[model samples]
Target: MPRSPLALAALATVAVPGLDAYDVRRPAQPGTDYDVAVVIDAHRRRWVVRAPAGAAAGAALEAEVEVLDALAEHTASGALPFAVPQPVGFAHLPEGGRAAVHAEIPGTPLRVDALQPGPGLAADLGRALAALHELPTSLVENAGLPVYEATEYRQRRQAEVDEAARTGKVPPALLRRWEELLEDVAMWRFRPTVVHGDLTAERVLVADGRVSGILGWGDTVVADPADDLSWLLVAASPEAADSVMEAYQLRRTELTDPHLQRRALLAGELALARWLLYGVRSGNTEVVEDAVAMLEDLDEHTRSLDAESSATYA
Candidate 1:
């Protein structure tokens, strides 16, 4: 359904807060079921309002609060090197509602489409990620943070695939291919580390050819680092992938386990599957097609890896 004219007009004409929403054209696509308001008040204060379903609102708000607390702890300890968005205030909605208000960062989001290749971009990303991972995990956990688990990942993937199949939006071949890919259970046992959990193009912000910030910690977790690496696999050009791996390896030198590689690759596949499902619900063809293409590439790669593993065993 088309957006209501009044809503469209309000979105177009209303001044955006903190940073210019003027440049923020309507997301070429609409977002999920949440209501988003980027508003700036008379004092030139800018903030973001994320209003999600009240049913999951409490849990979601707690999650956001945990992220903010993590950032704050990092900031206080001088460990958070990048410019992460900070929460200004949180308010409880009447009648069991949930919303978080955040102080908007001053720069435009570093979109993946505009990413330029350079010698250090990968290293920059790797180093920033290292900074994130290097922080004391114990401290964060003491504050009662959540970690994304393999069961959750599998269940989420299954839900999306099921939804697409039920709607007849997913091709049978694609569904079959994904099912075949799921037999590689060894890919799920990599070492656990801090992960942003939802590392996608939208969550990355770049400026001056360097990674200025990483956003969307709402789904952040102390899970396998491979979960975040999946985004790099998706975003980096094939040629650039080697460079990213090199940089990541340079900072994290102990990743010799084949299981780690498998986990990371599987995580990439899971991300693709989830996006495909999301595209089905949102009716976005670009997202759906790109996700499908990525999944195919990943399947081919995984097959090659399996062959290599078998040969090594022999």
Candidate 2:
């Protein structure tokens, strides 16, 4: 069961000594493993309180706290342009779990569809992502976060594709397309970089039309940078994506992979497969049905494109 906002507020008071009173309210719908709320103290200072849904999530929360601490202490001087959550306090729950408080980052979540095609905000977001990717891998490594080589990451993705295939639900054409991409050795060649492993649009925050903050660091890892770029390819408009890529390329110090955009697109496509697998594994029939509907839609779209190409050639 999830903890109430009021309950989390009480926990915040205990965790962060010096809060005589505060108002707590749910900020957004809870994620799979957390119940999140915003707490406004008597002095009008704001903070985010996150309580774990289970023991495994509690462990992840602790790990996130550690990562935030490391970033605050080690990387503050050369910090990226945007803000990351600062770990301020922690508390032990009555149910023997744990909760944490982070200084509130001031911004609303990015809504890609609502954005128009221009260099301003899009470029800022790209540059911010570049900064994050360019961060020294040592920070994550020393903090004991998951690190992987390009080949290793590809192997993991292949394994997931294989597992999804075994479920006997993924469409044959989609499976074949995914397998071909996975087996293309040249396509998988790239240096691993620090990545915000679960970088959906919602995790990116905007203020005054620029990226002001990034949230949800629990999946931080040293892995394929394409994972970080995948969301933008799907969510951002073509002109906006072009601007973003231009800024990202200009900002990056290291050699950018030529096939990075291709792989990012592939990653975006595979996300649906992962969603399907997750729904099946969790025994959520509704989710599974939804994923199936998406798969069918993808199949129709792919077929239409193929027909158009063949007609053009003829």
Candidate 3:
């Protein structure tokens, strides 16, 4: 069960000594593993309080504090183009975890449904992501985060595909397509860099039509740049997605893969497998069924596209 805003507020004071939280409410970003609240101190300063949902989440939250500190140092030396949560204090939870307080960042969460196609917020989002990828890998490495080479990354994806197949729920066609994509050596060729690893619409905060802040850093990894771009595909406007890519490509300090977009699409599609696996492992029938339904829909959708392509070529 989730903690109430008031409950989290109480914990906030304990985390940050001298914190006088007079008002506490919900925050804009969703918390999958943390019970979160926005606390307003006597000085009208906004602070965020998060209590971990489980032992794994608690561990990740603790690690994230270090990762943010490392990124914060880099931001001080060079521009990162956006704000990240700054941890100010921490307190251990009675539930065998921990809670922390952070200075709140400005801006509302980005909604992909409401994006402008031309170079505006979309371009800002692009540049923001490019800046993150451009950061030195030493920051994440020094902090003891996972770093992977191109071949290792490919092998990892292959292992996931194998696991999903074992569930006996994934469409055979989708499985075959993923396996073929994983086996394509040319598709796997790209420079590994620091990635946010779990980017989504809610993680990006926007204001004045520009990306102002990013939230969530626990899943940070040094891997394919395409993993970062996968969420941009959720943009309602194809032109907006294109704008993001144009800005990202322009701002990047190194050469990008020729098949980056294809790989990003592939990455997005593979998320269904992860969902299915999570559901099966947890014995959540509703989630497992939901994933299966989506898989079937995707299978039919892709097959129709293939049919149209074959006819077009013939």
Candidate 4:
């Protein structure tokens, strides 16, 4: 069961010495693996407190803290464009984990569906992505984060698809399509960068028409930049996605990687395979069925598009 707001507030007091909460409440969305709460201290300053639910979550929390510390150290000379969570204090949880407090970063998470095709929210997201990808690879390396070259990244993705295929739950058409996409070696050529590996609308915060903060850095890694853009495919409209990509391309310091968008599309498709594998491993039949259905839908959609293209050319 998720912890109560009162209990979490008490824990927050313990985490931050001499801090007295004036009020406390549940966050907008409670986390699955962490008991989280928003607390307002005596001076009316907002803070977020989170406690891990298990060993794995605890380890992830520790890793995130280390990475945040490394990032702060590396960016001491003012490199980052937005705020990242930094643990202000910590306390051991009684149930065999730990809780940490962080001052609440400004702004709510971006509403991606509302993004439009202009120099608006989508452009801000594009700029945010460019800023993150522009960060030095040494920052992630110094934090002991995972790093992967293009070939290695492709191989890992191929391995994941192989694992998903073994489950026999994924649609055969979708599997074949993914296999072909993965085998296209020419599309895999792009420079790796330090990416916020688990980027989604929820992790992106916007305030005053710009990205103000990024939350949850546990999945930070040096890998394919296209993987970061894949989330936009699912969340934003096509026109908005196009605007975001155009802005991203304009801001990038490197020469154009012509295949980046195609790779991003492939990455978005592969996410379904990953979900199916997770469901099969965890014995979640409902989720497995859902993933299979989605994959089938994507297969049908792709086939229709291909047929239309062939007809148009003829």
Query: All models: lDDT?
Result: 0.60, 0.86, 0.89, 0.87
Cα deviation in Å at residue 70, candidate 1? 2.2
Residue pairs in collision within model 3: none
lDDT by residue (tens digit), candidate 2, 37-141: 889988999988888988888888877777777777534675588888987788988777688888888888998887666688888988999999888898788
TM-score, per-candidate, Cα-based: 0.66, 0.95, 0.95, 0.95
Q: Mind giving the per-residue lDDT tens digits that candidate 1 earns over 43-149? A: 55655655554456457666767767767767667575567776665545454654565665555554554444456676677667766765655644754666556
Cα RMSD, model 4: 1.5
State the local distance difference test value for candidate 2: 0.86
Model 3 lDDT per residue over 81-177, tens place: 8889989988788878789899988888898988888879989888999999999888789888899999999999899889999999999998898
Candidate 1 steric clashes: 3
Number of the candidate with higher lDDT, 2 or 4 = 4
Best by lDDT: 3
Stretches of candidate 1 off by over 4 Å are: 1-30, 113-117, 143-145, 148-189, 253-261, 272-314
- In model 4, the Cα lDDT at residue 66 comes to 81
Off by over 4 Å in 3: 28-30
Better of 3 and 4 by lDDT: 3
**Least accurate 10 contiguous residues by lDDT in model 2:** 70-79
